[model samples]
Target chain A: MLHRIEPRSGVAFTLKRGQRLKVSDPEGEQVADLLAFNADDVDEVISSGRTLDYASRIFLTTGDPLYSNRSNVMLRLEEDRVGRHDFLLTPCSADTFRIIYGDEHPHRGCFGNLAAALAPFGIGPDRIPIAFNVFMNVTVDGATGELKVEPPRSRAGDYTVFAAEMDLIIGLTACSALQSNNYAFKPIHYEILD
Target chain B: MLHRIEPRSGVAFTLKRGQRLKVSDPEGEQVADLLAFNADDVDEVISSGRTLDYASRIFLTTGDPLYSNRSNVMLRLEEDRVGRHDFLLTPCSADTFRIIYGDEHPHRGCFGNLAAALAPFGIGPDRIPIAFNVFMNVTVDGATGELKVEPPRSRAGDYTVFAAEMDLIIGLTACSALQSNNYAFKPIHYEILD
Candidate 1:
């Protein structure tokens, strides 16, 4: 069954070892932020540092392993149609809107959405780390090392698949930031497969 | 008086608004990781996301502002003798050693050191975020967005000065990772100025 995540909202669930997850951009240009944590200990959560250090690249996609802070592989990217993703950029949050956009009223954004979604599993805001931003187009300037968020290349129905390596808690969000989605918000879809 | 952080160790202290912190590489080719938190509330910590988003560039130096997670300015870089630094990499940890280098006897690294030093202030490892790396040289491949850690350009006595924008709790470390300091561990020197 396809599970739908409404625009700017999030969901949390558990995936047993060997189960597969398919996250799809049902509406073109939307991005999803994905986070994984060990079911047994939240402290041993997914780590961008370890994964990037081992991979030696910022563009992670098919065949790449998402690593835990404790040096264990949590998931492997099994398929990816939209290859451009962001591991360096953090999830957009209320502070992001207030600081960068100078918005008078800031939405809680993905960080808040993830915090609320993961609260039932005892994950606090502090425990949230940098996410694997699926289908988010972030371009880094080669000469200056500057970062820019661009519109995702995904068309409708584009998706990525991940195979879980362990029992894992997952937090997935349809990114709430304006710039990340090219100024338009849209829903995301996901499905679990054994 | 100048304070010394011995190799592979760290220290935490408070800095009042308008006070200045000068972190110097007394020995050439050494690196230090620096973190700041709002003194009144530890939850309002320094944020790489807010800083980078507002700056639009990754290479932060003189005249740049380090922002808090709450979208407030925490520190301002007043002077920078070594222009190259990193805000993208997480502080090296035991997991960094075990995961990247496959070290069987891994050192606790800067993450553990910072957690230990800040424990008295009630800050835990989960509260630690990506640091402002002083004198650490990291280069990204322009074409592929791949990242590479390089030897710092700082010579002996090179330093950077930051003015606190608010009352803050600060964590500073003599980075423990070999690759970060060109394979040689050296002490870091710092002084608090009025």
Candidate 2:
């Protein structure tokens, strides 16, 4: 059975070691923010620095291992249809809106959504780290080190497969930031595979 | 009074709002990892994403405001003798040494130093986020998005002044990673200014 994550919403669940997760962009240009924490030790959460440092690259894809703070492999990217992803960015939140868009009343973005979804698992907002932004297009100007967020290049039905290297608590979101999805919202489709 | 953070060590203290803290490299080619949290609420901590987003640039210098995750200004770079700083990478840890350097018995890097120094304030290892790396030089290849850590250009006496925008618990470290400090660990000097 496939599970659907509503637009701007999120979900959290445990994935046993060796399990695979297929996250799909049913609607083209949608973004998903993914977080992983070791189920046995929540303190050992994913570390973007460790992953990027080991890979020596910012763009990660198939065969890349996602590492935890304790130098343990938590997940591996087994397959990918969209190659552009962002690990340098934090999930958008109410603060993102208020600060960037100047919105007085803002909707809870992916950060808040993840906080709510993962709260039942005993994870608090403070524990959340920089997420692996799936299908999110971000570019850095090398000359000046400026960052730009652009619409994703993922086509409809494009997906990525992640193989759990350890028992993991996974939190995934259909990103809510307008710029991340080109100003439109769409649901995310995901399925667990043996 | 001047405070000295010994090589490969760290210190944590409070900076009242409107006060300024000057961090200096007493010896050349050193790196300092700095972390800030709202003194009132530890959950509201420094955010690299918010700061980079608001500034639209990764190389922060004088006049750039360091933001909290809540989108509030925590500190502003009032003066910078070394213009290049890194908000992109994370503080090195035992995991970094083990994973990157393949060290069997790795020394606890900045992450562990900060954890020990900040423990008195009730902050845990899990709560630590990516720190603002002072005097650390990192370059990215635009074509490949690969990262390269280079020796810092800051000479002896190079310093930066951060004016607190809010009451903050500040953690500062004389980086322990050999690569970050060009293989020589040196002391970091700091002073509070009215």
Candidate 3:
């Protein structure tokens, strides 16, 4: 078993087949965005469209097979607790701050974090894709189909586990959408174990 | 082919099996949120969680099936052009007004329009679910796991077509997310075909 723990800041790593990754919110109420890619061919990556097409779902949970663009099975939901990871909404990027909050927005966004994390791995923006928004409280109104980007519904120690189906290039970002009503982008507990 | 075009406003209809519904951004860059219910049991309606769980996807596109909470297939994506509808983001609502944008943001939202439209059908707030956010520009940066919510990538008159798998009660709302960087909430084009 291989185990590595990365803090809430943006982080990236590779996991061999059968190795698993566990992401947790120690203080709770924090959301994290996660992305994964095929170590061999970055072009063959996770696709929300194709995954939803094959699984027929909009939100993700335990025991689900995460699919790639060509319908390749990339990972499996080995364990989950917060049950409500947002695979739907996009993460806030630096450009997102400029576009939504303006150019002077002080906080750094998930884009820069993920980009820098992957830069050492020789990955670039063109190879990037949206992430699996973990622990984010995004719910739809049962009355009018309105969607809300609320805070995570989890308590301290809530976590989810993912198993790599193949060699995987992983990008992880602690979400920094401060206006999302959280005190701050809390630290994320990331561990990869064999 | 039963064809009816509803202007950019909330509209409700009962689609029988084999019927098809087309939602369009006639002038372009408009988003339409859609919600569906089982004509037999409204309780077993659209579940964003289950839909994404089953599909292993976050975005909707051509040939994808919309599933209910009970995992029943509701609608199938027959065709799509501006393939960016948000099933992840919640539609703006009345209570949501004071929550996110505070009490000051003007412009009517999808909730009011959808509620009024479904009022005649006796579908109340408890029955509504997060809509399929159509043509809403939501993309993620794969390398850094950054998400972006910009305007639609469609040109004028691009559209998506959905086929009803079962008898469905659909409530359509032209998004009036006034904060979504437009002159105002632009009107959308809704047409139901045979």
Per residue, candidate 3 scores C-alpha lDDT tens digits across B74-142 of 999999997666675555665445544566754346767787888787887534556788787765443
Tens digits of per-residue lDDT for model 3, A146-187: 455677877798899999998989988777767442756577
Candidate 1 residue spans exceeding 4 A from truth: none
* lDDT by residue for model 2 (A29-92), tens: 9999999998987888987767887788888889999888776889999999998898888889
Model 2 chain A worst lDDT window (10 residues): A47-56
| Worst window of 10 by summed lDDT in candidate 3 chain B | B139-148
Per-candidate Cα lDDT values, in order, are 0.90, 0.90, 0.69
Q: Candidate 3: where is the Cα deviation over 4 Å?
A: A1-8, A142-145, A179-181, B1-194
Docking quality band of candidate 1, CAPRI definitions: medium
| Per-residue lDDT over A56-109 for candidate 1, one digit per residue giving the tens place of the 0 to 100 score | 788888999998876689999999999888887668898778777888899999
Better of 1 and 2 by DockQ: 2
Order of candidate numbers by TM-score, starting with the best: 2, 1, 3
